[model samples]
Target: MHSLRNTRLPFKVSLSLLSLSLILPIQTSGLLFKPLTLPPSHPLSLQSYQPLTSATTTTTITTNNTTPSPLTLSTNMTLFYPAETAPHKATILGFPSTHAVPRDLLNQTRNEIMDLAVVISEFEPVRVHVRPEDESLARRILNERFQKLEDINNNNNNNNNNRTKKAKAKRFNLLNRRTRDNNSKEDDIPQYHLDRITFHPCPTNHPWVRDTAPVYVLDKSNPAHRIAIDFGFCEWGGKNLREINVRNEPLGLEADGEDERSPVSSRKGYAAPDNRHWENARFAKRVLEREFDLDEQAENNEIKVERVVSPLRLEGGALEVDGEGTFLATESSIICPHRNPSSSLTTREAIESHLRALLGVTKIIWFPGRKGLDITDCHVDGEVKFIEPGLVVQNKPHPKTGKAEMEIYKEIKEILGRETDAQGRKIRVVELEAADPDLVGWGGDYDEGGEEELEKEQEEAAGTYVNFYFVNGGLIVPAFGDQKRDRKAVETLRGLISPERKIRQVYVSALPLMGGVVHCVTQQVI
Candidate 1:
């Protein structure tokens, strides 16, 4: 049984990048936003990086050798949602089990998460947070993985050991780029030692860590210093309030809060059952700050947390940034009245200012993303991603999803094509067809209620290959079992990434059903 040690740590507390099993659909994307000006673009490099040397603190890097930029604020904090290829200290993951989910669904979800974690660990470290009660389960799963890997490596243990040593030597030389050669035979699978993963006790609401966890930034002045930015989460602006309220009720029906607080008929609008969800974000910030040793620099005058207490509620997925100056976002998800009601960002200028301050992007490209197209109101990550600086890749619209998405895609392509990046370079956009529904595979059949209902669920399950996540020298992509398309997606993505990077495809058929992909569930610590 999962631990019930703290009421604050309930099943609903766990969040993923995609959706949870909760009825109201806690699946969504965004980041906490405020206004700031776009600073000039400058080249930044990880000159002093030393990976895997310290478990508690990440290696510091510098932008240049002399007259470093002043944006580092004594806090040494610069929010760079740069290309995923940028070096990462670790990746964060959350595990949750809920009574609301069937056993088969829960098991499948956990296994998939484990698969993702294992693959990510191959490139960089992975820090997993689980309820105290589930620690044993997590360990058992990881142990089995370790054993399986050991058996494989054992076949040629001596030769593999020599190769591992050589790889480590090569890794040190590429510290500035945080890259490594992709020529190793054990490139696809991680080592058996399991030295890269650290399990911690943290409570979360669902597993959408990317959306719910605090965003990390490095100090502009001192790239070594890190800060945790806690963007507030309210279950997609109380869209999940009804489910939270219902779960809180003893009878699981009828209104529990005052009418004024009700999302259905409230002057204040829908308030979550409690701020327990916020705890996960807060917990992540605290834990990460400590792990990264951001606090010990007490003399440096770093704020423990940078809270973007803005009316604009956002998930990290809503914004795509190229650390240099270019930023991409959708208007419907961030600016629409549904998500930003009563926010101070009433105009395009206001929105731009907020994004600049919060995300540090100067040039903003906005797409008229369709509202209600997905629960997230259309996060940009699902449709577009920055492969590297000045280069963006977008998914071609699927005929099955309809005209609204196609219209949005066309507008995005046109705008991006005309616009220039913050660095004053014409944006380069690449097009790749989104994974079709037929290519996507599900773990098990849905309840035999009716074909119409099942069809609706399957339609929603159509996730795209664009939702892949980047690691040190690898790209972890979602494989929907459509053999042909899956292989093609892999090849296409491989062509876009640096030669040093390889592809790791994990079967995540369930992620699409929840309105997310691999990037949704994982939040990289840069």
Candidate 2:
């Protein structure tokens, strides 16, 4: 059983992100929104950065950044949605709990998170929202990771005792971005990078903060200012609300065809009593509304953050913004019956208008994303990512993948070939191949017929490389144990992205099994 110790530390609570399992339903594409004069495009590279002590603390990581040009949009624009590559004050992730990672996979989940947190902290500070009960366990896990690193360093030092000082120093300062820590020896993640990690005691139903957390947008009025859009979540159509080990409630139903399935069937992610993920939704709002109960920073240094409440319900993983004015999303993830489930929000125009009002979105490049595929109904993050406005990367499925999955990627390529972005720039699409499913080995953990739902659902997240997270000066990508493909992924991203930004892969096994990856679990506060 998972520990529920009552020891309470100084609580700092802010939480978000969710992943749901469901089938995919194809929708029509091509809804080009009218153009709007948006904020100028800028490259994200930080000469300097401020540590994130609160959610509202604003920071910029833009190179040769420019102010927003005057806008002629339908809505009076204030909040500017920066691209994922934009400078981030900090990145937030939730520590996996009982139901999210399952009991048997808890150790693997924690280890994966440990690898992610430590490596990410090498680039920027990380905020981990750990439930109060799991605080000590989380700390222990990190400390163990730190000690393991120290041992490895010690071994290296012993082996290369006669190495020259200059060679050692050169080997130590690898990226040349982070200055050496004077206090620590060799500066090799001294103290497991624990100094860069801050823990917040909070409640979380699921740990995919990309879906549950606030989608931050920079304010055009003030570049140092930010707005947190709480695009309310419904547990990915409430399909993933069920805890692990919960059996799929039988409804005397079976699949009719690929395009059709019973909505109430609970076969994908299992059925829970209700979503009950409202705590995470409320957590999103509290960040903007309340005083930082644990904020230690001075008042003058804090960046101003504004909040805009919206009726739209979607996860951060569903929408990909170019940090200009264009938006990309799966149609089923946003406008379907579950997310925008109201008479007023039914139409495409209505949903687009709300997006415009909320984030000043000018053009929406819609893909016929299949609904009920994985926990996200085919979240766009799993398929495509905007390197900037014009340049983007997509996941090309393994050749052995199902016809349904292959067709989806083919459509994405076709759309990119035809469509223009919000700023009238033709999009450039790069294809990144996913790891072969047969080659992805999850070392005999799950019970036979345990969590593997169905053949179609399993193929959705079979080592997808696009679901990666962006830190301040780094990209956190998943490694699916395929050495060749994993190495190829790093090389590809390095060639495509900024030279200063490093591409690091964290070996992920359990989350991908649950239909999520690095991007699903992490959120950036810009």
lDDT of 1 by residue, 1-526 (tens): 0001111111232212211111111211232222122222321211111122323222211122222222322244455445566788788887744422223345555656776777677788887877677889988876665554344434333445554443322221110011123443443344422677778876554567777666766556556645555544444433433233223432111344322221221122222343332343254443543452423334444343333222345677776888887888888767754443332334566566656655667788888886655556677888888888778888876566566768877988998888888888887888867656654433222122221111123243545777878888788887654445566777677677876676766665544555566888888776
In model 1, where is the ten-residue run with the lowest total lDDT? 1-10
Q: Report lDDT (Cα) of residue 427, candidate 1.
A: 79
What is the per-residue lDDT of model 2 for residues 176-232, given as tens digits with 9 covering 90 to 100?
112122222353332336798888877664677887777888657667555677765
Which runs in model 1 stand beyond 4 Å of their true positions?
1-81, 99-104, 145-189, 241-311, 443-458
| Backbone atom clashes (below 3 Å) for every candidate | 30, 21
TM-score of the candidate numbered 2? 0.70
Please name the candidate that would achieve the greatest lDDT relative to the true structure.
2
